[model samples]
Target: MSAVQTQPGGGETRYRIAVDTGGTFTDVVVGSSTGDMAVGKALTTYDRVFTGFEGAVRRAAQSVGWDGDEVLRNADVIVYGTTHATNAVLTGRVAKTALLVTDGFADTLLLREGGRRDAFDSKAAYPPPYIPRQLTFEITERLSAEGEVLTPLDEEQVRSVLRTFPDHGIEAIAVACLWSIINDVHESRIAELIEEVLPGVPYTLSNDANPTIREYRRASAASIDASLKPLMADHLGKLRGDLLQFGFDGDLLVVTSEGAVLDVVDVLDRPVLLLNSGPSMAPLVGAAAAPERETVVVCDMGGTTYDVSLVEKGVVRHTREAWLGEPFVGHLTGLSSVAVTSIGAGGGSIAWIDAGGLLRVGPQSARSTPGPAAYGLGGEEPTVTDACVVLGYLDAQGFEGGFTLDHDAAVKAIETRIAKPLGMDVLVAAQAILDVSGHQMATATRQAALEHGVDPRGALIVAGGGAGAMVAAIIGNILEADTVLIPATAGVLAAYGAHRAPIATEFLSPLHNDTRNFDSASAASAVKELGKKAKFFAARFETVNPDAQFSYFVDARYPGQAWDLRVYLDGAPDATGDAARQIEDAFHAEHDRRNGTHDPASRVEIITWGVRVEIPRHELLSDEVTVTGESVVHRHDPIVFGGESHVTPRYRGVTLSPGQHIAGPAIIDQPTTTIVIPPEWDADLDDRSNIYLNRKEA
Candidate 1:
């Protein structure tokens, strides 16, 4: 990683810090430019985000023999990945926002693409829009599809409508006039009026936010971007101020939904990009770990939810339909992001009996506040983490974050809440809780792979997060995967991934052209314009990283298709006959792989032109890890597996050297997490300290 600030001389070397804040814990990773680092974790303090952050950083610094505040002051840059913006949107805790669209489009949000999850189930209620209909005001203006003004801007009417916004306690505004992608004058003028009327009130123009062909999606993007302004602005401002108060003065970068870093100021303006930012980084690690693998499955298990993503053929897939809540009924983000499927089963997922007397793991969690009962934090519910503790998989002394696990509390919680009710043994009940959650993880991994037209069997599974290794081999066993690879930094992989993430941004231009009769000049000009924006953005982002890489993409589909597939071009196209064919071929191949079929003879309709600029990432240097002695089991404990108790040997993972292997019912506990080796598997440590668990021969 590059330095963001000048390094002060005298024994203080340039260092980079990456912090990932999840629902339960905050993980901090401090590394040198060569990527050797230490991970420290702590319970998340939601009330003060920096409190837990400082605690985690201090532990990491202490491990490296440095004072906490001194490390902060001497750091080069800190890349942070947080879930604050995502949580706020999902809980409706964001700023109050008003949506202003063109006349006759007041029902755009109310109708919400008019789709339902189950078409046969008419009893399901329609979900609420991002901005309530009552707050959606229609501006009396119109523009044709070709950028011609069908009706001139009603400036007085706009001013009158906005003047009353203050009374409604609106904190931000989103202006999404129809055809704004073609001509932005109407939306641009509204932005100016907003600045004049409400000087500090944040406003977003659809053209500047997401230049897409779909009016509804563009409007949705604008609505979300506007809604996040006040909340994210204050939240990010406080974070910066906290850093300054700690006497640390360096650049601060934040991860995006696209699995890259952005300037803090840029994130404040486009906070919508912060959604799913942490989960997106898991695929980055997977892709880099086994880039040549045809299909790589990455599962990041946190306290509240587990995210599953796939890296197919060395590329991390991105999707545009990232929903905030339910799939068909929830608000869409309308921006490009890494495709991640999340299941509500993790370390802290509460296990309960359903109405039918069936065991269910979770759609609800204990989060970090009271955490799992194993933490002795006053939580009475039996959670997945409690199961781990009750079964003796988690070691009290080896646990990270300087916390001790309570075996008695875990047993009591399960015995009262689950075992007694089910009339089962305490250990069996705990094992059942893990069985259910493991089923969910396996199901999600299978679905994620199958949905992408890839077979789950014979794939390489890369597990991450604090709780991921606990079930990595279990998922592989269920799916018949060939190998499960656990990186050395698996416990804090998301935070460590920040050290590898590139500084990147994307620009889009709406160009509705077809392959049959392509408008070469028009398409070329749009691509050229996108390139200009990329360069301008890079110029501003250069202070953080100077090197850059550019990639071109287009949204294209068969002529009769309702939706398009985003395809990347090998290089920026000149839009000649050959260039058109290249795009058409690329789209066809991707569409064929994703949809299982494509119409080669049909004309491909290209809707949007895009260019992504990113700082080229430097490959991490893998160091060989060797210990003075062979891997040794320090203790033995009764670990429950397959609903039965087995005395498993526990080994300290960090003390193991390369070429050392452990077989069968065994536990390898590291400072950050634990890995359980199943009865049929063997674990081997590689030179880079990555553990590979492989099943025995049939």
Candidate 2:
């Protein structure tokens, strides 16, 4: 396809566009300078990703009476978030990789930190490592923890080992020598030999990708990054080439797991940093949708997974210990990122009977291909969408994007897989599925909140994703939160968040120092070095926004502790008495808030220091639109609840005014999503078009 040219419009109108590619759908959102917003969605096409991306954007542009190419030509910035890296790692579609470790530590990747979720289950088998042990080669190099060389590098041995790569079909390589973070001389030399012998093969060094203290984690990060080199480099290169071909003259940015956007060149170097890129934006969108609420829980129930995150008092929760596939049981990125807890219980999650004849809602999903029996895509198994269809909660004819849902096929799948085996009617079985899935999500949400020491009861829960609005009320009621806020653009909320995300980059350095006699000169030098690196990275965003800001943080803990608490340090890391005192107070405050206790007399040790640089994001201001009349209900339908049917009034969401109120047992239908307010609940619309659901009082 070629770019379609149209008549030139005024050059003063600029647009901000963002596209988020999830496992099941690709959502596109556009924000015009005139305070107008539009969204478009299409099923995810894994084969040719840009096809779905362009299709979604074209649909959105058409709604605003503009050609897709014209919209790109008039855009100021375009940001994108995708699950490509995550999917590649999960499906084992990455390149054949080789690992080079110190002579005796070849099993570092195989023997991960040597822990499991269950300590007593010795019979349980270990999950496969990112790379097998047979693919690992030993290097004759070593360095002490204090950065002193223990054994000189064997240059001939390095050459000999790399010469065999062609026979082994190693497309990528990872180098992880002992104490490489302190002294990377040996690793650097090996890299030079690889470039000479294996000219085109891409490789990753642990010191460059992740300069942390842990050996296993750093090696894991390097392995994952190296394995993704060929896959991500090609994908991102093609995406950029396609965008330029389609007349997008503005800068193209990729969102990172840090809740900010980075240039494609920066992301290509370390694709592991984008593991949780898409889901990381949901919390930011939740905070922006309801700026009035300080604490908010974002529940995004997408087609494949239910992701939950938190923002306390406007600060998005960030963690350095984020795992990719499974927490503790899966591969760790070893990079700092926004903390999100995910469960495999979304609209497309499959429902099936176990060997013992027990009904179970998924940890398995149908994804987009043959998604759900209702999609008429030749799926024989029942999904959560089928349950919604059987219970009359969803209108098959009025489905999202004008796509028809096959109700008969949904009934057949449910009856065949779930109902008959459970000895129940179709409707009853569907409700049971909904109940089980909802409870699972609710429990996971509550645990995510409570584990962070935040009480979700008084917090506002913002719901997003395609199926987010459908279960917002029930999940909120289950958590007993004050209210739940569902944005009008719930279908593409992640893309909206990407649109508003700032251009940011982060730098981390290891600084092992004691707080009592902190070396002011050493700390100041480290800060200066980190600042220089951060400034260099932030230069990429200067074209979009010139004013860049930087913040400093220190990971500290009492002496003899295994873990450290991250404390925000104001200003630069000088050795002044005031700076030291401020850090001590901040550490104590954070410790108290997190663990409910603090010891001021204990000597603190600084483990690592970091710097964050960002260009302030554009504020998402709410526009006031005048409503001329009272809202009217256009239709009514009977919905089954609690084994009984109730006639529910259905209203178009766009026709509702700011002060409008809809009682329980009602449905609010929008173009892309539907909100179901069950019995004993009421819905209120705020001025910003945000819906709030609360329980009714007797």
Off by over 4 Å in 2: 1-9, 119-126, 292-294, 619-622, 625-632
Each model's lDDT comes to 0.85, 0.83
Q: Per-residue CA lDDT of candidate 1, range 488-578, in tens?
A: 8899878888878988888998879988898999998998898888888888867556777889999888877888889999989887558
Per-residue C-alpha lDDT of model 2 across residues 58-126, encoded as one tens digit per residue: 778776566677677777778889989887888899999999999999878766765466757787766
TM-score of 2: 0.95
lDDT of 1 at 127: 66
**What is the Cα-based TM-score of model 1?**
0.96
Considering summed lDDT, which 10 consecutive residues are worst modelled in model 1?
A: 1-10
